[model samples]
Target: MERKQTAELTNLVMVYDDNGNVLVEEKVGSNYRGLIFPGGHVEPGEAFVDSAIREIQEETGLNIKNVKLCGVKNWVEFDGSRYIVFLYKTNKFSGELTSSDEGRVFWMPLEKLRKAENKLWHMDQMLELSCGNTYSELYFNRNDSAIKPILK
Candidate 1:
């Protein structure tokens, strides 16, 4: 079958706790099967920021607020279409985590997630970009086997 590629806009939130643990979800029934932060597409006419909050609430049942826009990640899929994801992070939120149709949700230590087996696609790079209290954009070229930065 031919791979279908298209331009897409998405969001990914990195929710953290007072103890420094981060919430991650294990995605199911897709090519991207692994631990990933909760996030989804921005509906047409919906604000990007609003989409982030709504996605977290729907996927994790957490009423998140006061989230800071960390950065943006841009990549070209193997089939050549571009995919861009706006990243947000927040330690300020409430409500118990709930399971969603997307996957199982839970908290995991940051270090543990850094381990080889648990790492999601481009996660380490995303975390590094979030280290500073500033906003920026990251560009990458991605395929089934690798995700490399587009430096230039």
Candidate 2:
């Protein structure tokens, strides 16, 4: 029997301020629309952390450093391929905030963001994982009905 392989790799970074706020991107033109962290797919032969940093800069115009790897989210597709998203967090960054074609980037209070209705599905779980409160997020696709997230 042959083993399945990971088909896609991505990252999600939580950039927070000292004032209890987190940087967010209000995604506009994608199926996974809504508020989300600044991140993107990892390029071939590129480092994971480097990808995270590069994505942040591209999406939010922030130069982040000392990013801490908090956790990961992963799931298997119907085609038997897996997708993995590395979660990271960092309070260290410097740049004039700007928005890109990806979304409108802005800062929101953590508490306020928690209560926002426009957040993407599983944003809460992703936040927990990115904050180191959880080790990983395992997604289950059940009978093509709904996607269930299990935090570990």
Name the best candidate (by lDDT): 2
Off by over 4 Å in 1: 1-6, 78-80, 132-135, 142-152
How well is each residue in 17-129 modelled by candidate 1, as lDDT tens digits?
A: 98869999898765667888889998888898999999999999999998888888888878789888999999999998998999999999888887747657677777765
Angstrom error of the Cα, residue 45, model 1: value is 0.7
Scored by TM-score, the top model is 2
RMSD of each: 4.8, 2.0
lDDT for residue 46 in candidate 1, whole number 0-100: 88
Please, what are the lDDT tens digits per residue for candidate 2 over residues 50-108? 99999999998899999998877777678777788888999999999999998899999
Q: What are the clashing pairs of model 1?
A: none
Candidate 2, residue 27: Cα displacement in angstroms equals 0.6
My TM-score estimates for the predictions, one after another, are 0.82, 0.89
Whole-model Cα lDDT of every candidate shown, in order:
0.83, 0.85
Collision count for each candidate, in order: 0, 0
